[model samples]
Target: MLVRGKADRASRPNLLGDLDIPSGLSASVGISEFTYRKGQEVYSENDPAEYVYQVRKGAVRRYKLLSDGRRQIGAFHLSGDIFGLENALVHRLSAEAVVETSVRLFKRQSLENGAETDANVFHRLLSMTTKNLRHAEDHMLLLGRKSSVEKVAAFLLEMDGRLTSAGLLSLPMGRRDIADYLGLTLETVSRAVNQLQREAVLKFIGKTHREIVILDRLRLSSFDIPG
Candidate 1:
């Protein structure tokens, strides 16, 4: 269940952090904020694409169910990241809160209406679409061509760039989630992470290995290669 924030739109910092929506365009729409507990379902697959969301805090995972009853995670949306943006009528993947997450959302129609008359808004929307496409292309290569270590290295580098805080890369998802995202088995992912640690590329911090500190970023990047 979505627990909508009581604050009005005017009190919010920005309408769309990724889109950097114009103040005028944002004022015309009613943005609703909601908080979801860890493991809460945000939306199911094939649901009507009524809204687009921006992460205010915490993270979300978007995934699809495979034929053999396996879950394939397509993407992980971190703080300030956008999700559920769609040009189609329905969502392709189901979304769930990876942790206690807060998100701001607005109807998709508001953006559509704004884009019709505003070239700037239209361009921003196009840019976002292109970004998602690029990510999809990269993921395809990672899953099909990369080795287990390479996949884990690539994932660490990605989290380092996106959500690393105070020199520590604190990952929200677990081994199972990482395995699904990287198209690897849980043991493979675990071994890869341990290998990186043994090689002195990264050190596991905190009570769990999810809290990591990259000791040698260049070495980690070298493992990722083009994929």
Candidate 2:
């Protein structure tokens, strides 16, 4: 299914939007509250996933756990995005709210039942899944082929597009998380970031290492490989 653009008139309303779903459909969905302190687990792998979540605020990370305690973070879900969709039996990857966060949730059974009866809603869900898959595929290519600087540049560009505000971009995750996401070591991430700073691609802000100002948007876009 073709995903609708945010500015398109035909765009569907997100959970945070004002579009009114049918009462029957809306009744199947209800909000739930969850909180995770930094490094806390929201849900473990193989846990029964009774619901799928939409981020109301903050961020979440989904990752796979190896038997030897190695972890590969698959993706991060930020505000206005959805996550926690899983098979009927159990969750394949573990999810954790990246900070103190709250999410709006709908029961898995309810979502399935709603989907069975509502083609439009089902299409919307599938479209969301498709968008996620596309990002994962693009990230896989970045991980496999991109240089460390290129990867970091691509990551910054992505975050800039998705979350920048008034010339400043605030990273929701830490350097270690960024390293894992980019398939680089933390030192590598630091070096690439410092390089970007020295090159006037971005400006560092604050001592906490969360805020950055983009100095050259066009140059940053050039780092991403053509999709």
In angstroms, the error of model 2 at 104 is 1.4
Candidate 1's residue-wise lDDT over 22-63, tens digit each? 678777667788999999998999999999888888899999
RMSD of each: 2.1, 6.7
Model 1 stretches astray by more than 4 angstroms: 6-13, 16-28
Task: For candidate 1, give the lDDT of residue 201.
Answer: 97
Candidate 2 segments whose C-alpha is farther than 4 A from its true place: 1-21
TM-score of each: 0.92, 0.86
TM-score of 2: 0.86
Residue 84 deviation, candidate 2, in Å? 1.3
Top-scoring candidate (TM-score): 1
lDDT per residue (tens digit) for residues 1-227 in model 2 = 12212243344226623223456677657745554566677788899998777765678888886677666788888877887776458988888867766566667777677667877667777877788789889788878745788889888888888889888899889988888787788999999898888889888799987899998988777777643
The Cα RMSD of model 1 versus the native structure comes to 2.1
